[model samples]
Target: MKTPWAVVVGEVADVKENSPDLPLKQQYYIPDEQEAEMAGSLGSPTDIADNGGYIVLRTAMAPEQMENLLRSTVHSIDPQLPLTQVQSMEHAISDSEAPRRFNTALITSFASIAVLLAILGIYSVIAFSVALRVQEMAIRMALGSQRSGIFRLVVLSGAKLALFGCGIGLAGAVAASRLLRSFLFGVSPFDPLVLTLATISLLLLALVASLLPASRAASVDLTEALRSE
Candidate 1:
């Protein structure tokens, strides 16, 4: 009867290095049944020796079981050799992915907080600026400035501030992105698409922040504003 198995082919040096001080009989393979049956009939221990390779019996075994078997086999063969850096393939794969996942999570969290703070800061600045400019806005209205014009002026001021900040931020990001190259996977730190999207988003947020203030400015009553001053 044929037993199913997985063939684990690695460099001889790697196998020896990973499985030092192990005996052959204690070692087992996750076998391919078809190949094992074809090869098993041709070899005794002496015949297997002339082939410069070893065969493993395919049986029901977990990864841990296979690992233990291989370690024991190596130890049986060479008791003096030390087994070092022994690990399951699954563990190696997980170790490889851990750093990438950590970096992604950290970047995502920082970006979220930065965006939230930017929106809040913009909103507060525009609100305060509009409040301070109420007297000036009333004067403009009294002097025949159109509501639309006042609105445009307020929005333009906010846009100018946004553009200035974004320009500086873009430069800083470009300079800082180089340090993050190791953390980036598929996307470049200096990606044009990312920069363009960020700029557009920040500008849009600035516009939104300024809108309420602009509307308030435009709706200011010349008589009431003048009387209050």
Candidate 2:
């Protein structure tokens, strides 16, 4: 195979035909004569080289019809020739991506559960704080504090904690992204838009979680809350 053959490299092709993660490497396209020479050295005929190769055909026919036609055509040349792994281009791409898709889905499910737990934790902490400060809230309203002020106080308190946690989470996420570089395609590990969106979503949910506690604080019965203390 190393023997020199008088052949010209007609063209050069560059493609990511397999996967984007695959490294760029050289692939030689030698002529039939060179192939035959290599095959002879390996104690095989030139036709062995042609035993496996792809045939792409574009047609208006349905896949089933096209497959039948392809089978008939190939068998016409040699009835014993077998056709295997017959599928459309879309199917081929999907098949190749199946594993990646599964991993993405599994990660997404776990991420969703983690976010839900975070929202619940925020809600519980804010609700507990509101419960403990019920008399303080009642006294403030009894004096001159507006109900709107109490509501804003509670909500803003939760929001501050949420924002702080979000900052730490963002830092952690940026660090963790590098681990997922191999699984990612067509995007950077540190995708700013995605990180921003995730942070915003968590913050919004935290605010929503704070709403119930804020409402209860604002609507406290001044006489009853003060008497209880």
Candidate 3:
């Protein structure tokens, strides 16, 4: 049911291809000449391109040298022809990702700040608990419990809280990551590697935050702790 170019319209075969900048659905592929004819028929200028096209080149030589060679070759063929935006594949990909990189940096900064605040919060909670239990700790030490045991006990408490918090956070993250799918590339929103790394990082930070309070609890002066009660 087409009125354009006089060519046989054969049954279409599905082909799967991916482009980072373009959608994958409802795409057509035709010869350059045929596409030009169709564009002309649609009242568009076929003599000149509105947007420039790009060429992909593979070479064993260095990119800078290849770019120079390409420019010289193009000039030799047509002195009037001008090539703009000549760049290596790496540069092109990086340029395309410039905005994405900025977004990622912003997200990372916010996430870092949030993690810092969480660590501080954990430290505060553990420190307060240690202060309140000073008498109990003094009694335990008097009854032959070692300072190292007190340190271990305090650290284990923090770890248990961290584990519980991480479990809940992971659940929320799995739900929230769906919103981030648009910003991510080449990785799934539910990527196991990323989740594992985040969990491990948070747990380690929690342990670190608990360390100072644990140390203080272990070094508590028995007289001061007993008198404070």
Candidate 4:
């Protein structure tokens, strides 16, 4: 038994009614044997069923090449027939999905840049705060505060600021969800998993950013800090 290839046979009426956006003037499918017979008779008035009226080309040809061949054959049969819209199914599907992929890539790039800037801002603020409190840290050390205690205090302070900022950010994200609805696919704007993961990631990043400053505070020398002040 010869292997049969499945090709889509779109009815002219159905295409016109259902897909007004499509530019295709007419489309049909016929079997390979009937292709030559229909070639001479194309553009002639003949009663044909919508489902199985057309010729089916050999499966060896790509959809694009097959579409081109069909167009050429039809145009040769009737030169006056205006070919306004002719496209392969592959091209149609690709065109339909291209915009979505491009949008996703753009949004992902912007999100990455925003996260990088946030991390840098957190690091700078924590570093500056630690620098300004150097003398205070030195005094605490001199008075008998443990190094671990100083480190914990600095980290906690940074954590409090990060938490506050994150809270505000979360509120803004919630409000902006409506505006982002059109861009989202396969995921909800307020997905709990996404929000939870984002929160945890941001908190971890903030902690990492504060680590260097916290370490410096813990290592402060009481004698030198007091002498400098």
Candidate 5:
């Protein structure tokens, strides 16, 4: 803003980042004394502000006690003067963070459930495939196919499916990045590190799930398998 006749100028402060939740805008700050002086010049000295102000106190006593003292002191001058929302800075900051914290918790809970379901679904599919292919695994053993080879074959099958899922999920996430941006704080919606870590976790779980059935297949008794088949 300019002076009364647009004749004076104000120095700009260094650019600084603001809270993510707050929208971008142009705002200026002036000392309380200068603001009060400006108000007095307007001929409404008692109009000090938009009838709103904050009083901060550093005290050993609890905030509730300090609030009572402040209210009584203000009332002694004018009983009509009001005091409200008398809270410490700590409380104010905590209240501001409450919504963000709750959102994070809720998203985390849903993500965890999704991961669990992915793990169980992959395990079930791989286990069933291994069970149906037991005779084939037995024949491979009978024909001198190495146990390590069979293990790799089974595990790779599950890994393939997990990899496919990761690819689709990543693509969908990138496409919806704009929609997801509001829910993120201090993080990009399409953060590569986050995607990489999630992909790796899914692959590791897939590997573990495949390992159990693969191990069972590798240890098959060829003679008993041939007779049963």
Candidate 6:
């Protein structure tokens, strides 16, 4: 939709209402000569048109190399002119995105630490449970439980716990997706691909954590385990 500013603009070449940062406001662009003449009549004389304008150039060479040349060229035209915010396109983009990059890295670091702790916790719990069940395992082995059965028993138990945890987490994420909708960028809060990858990663880690204990249970010394009781 057009606003009262359309009078000054005459007609817009394009609109950028889709931009998240831009809001409905009075904004228009006009030629520098017409603007200067208008401003001169308003006692805000724009002499060399140094007050505003954007210089966009494309070059294969490094942007840094152009900075000095651009500044000197501008100064050569008018010695009193000052160049402000002279930065490369890459630098401008990086500067604008610096905060988001820092936040993502910080959150990722915490998530990694949380995953590592979960893996350690899983390993400890399964190992302790196996230790406590040594006598039961020994009796089972003596009563004709095969080594493969023992392995399956431990691994399957851990798998159940892992799957249960993932289910709970996925449910919680879905419930909170609305609350988190604004914070996510480039991806949806409930993006299925990301969620599936995360779930798979946790399950794999949990299975890895259980492997040592499962192997220990499967190859355990039946006589020692029974005699220790």
**RMSD in Å for all candidates:** 11.6, 2.8, 4.3, 9.6, 4.2, 4.6
lDDT of 6: 0.80
**True-structure lDDT of candidate 2:** 0.86
In model 1, which range of ten residues has the least summed lDDT? 13-22
Give every collision pair in model 2.
none
Query: In angstroms, what RMSD does candidate 1 have relative to the true structure?
Result: 11.6
- Tens digits of per-residue lDDT for model 1, 30-74: 334444454575545553343234344455678678768877988
- Per-residue C-alpha lDDT of model 3 across residues 1-229, encoded as one tens digit per residue: 3456656567576544433634556656566677676656454563535456667799999988998999999999989888999888788778777887898899999989988998999999999999988888889999999999999999998998899989998888878887888887667878899889999999999999999999999999999888874
29-139 per-residue lDDT for model 6 (tens digits) = 767666555554443433534656668788776767888788889999999977788877777767766776787798789889988988898899899999999888888
Q: Which sequence of candidate numbers ranks them by TM-score, best first?
A: 2, 6, 5, 3, 4, 1
Query: Which has the greatest TM-score?
Result: 2
Error of 3 at 60 (Å): 3.6
Q: Over the full model, what C-alpha lDDT does candidate 4 score relative to the true structure?
A: 0.76
* TM-score computed on alpha carbons, candidate 5: 0.77
Best by lDDT: 2
Q: For model 4, state the Cα shift of residue 51 in Å.
A: 16
Score every model by TM-score.
0.59, 0.87, 0.76, 0.63, 0.77, 0.81
Which runs of model 3 end up more than 4 angstroms from their true locations? 1-22, 25-52
Model 1's alpha-carbon lDDT is 0.76
Q: State, as a TM-score between 0 and 1, how close model 1 is to the true structure.
A: 0.59
| lDDT for model 3 | 0.85
Candidate 5 residue spans exceeding 4 A from truth: 1-19, 31-33, 39-49, 57-83
lDDT scores in order: 0.76, 0.86, 0.85, 0.76, 0.81, 0.80
Which 10 residues in a row give candidate 4 its minimum summed lDDT? Answer: 43-52
Output the worst ten-in-a-row residue range by lDDT, candidate 6: 1-10
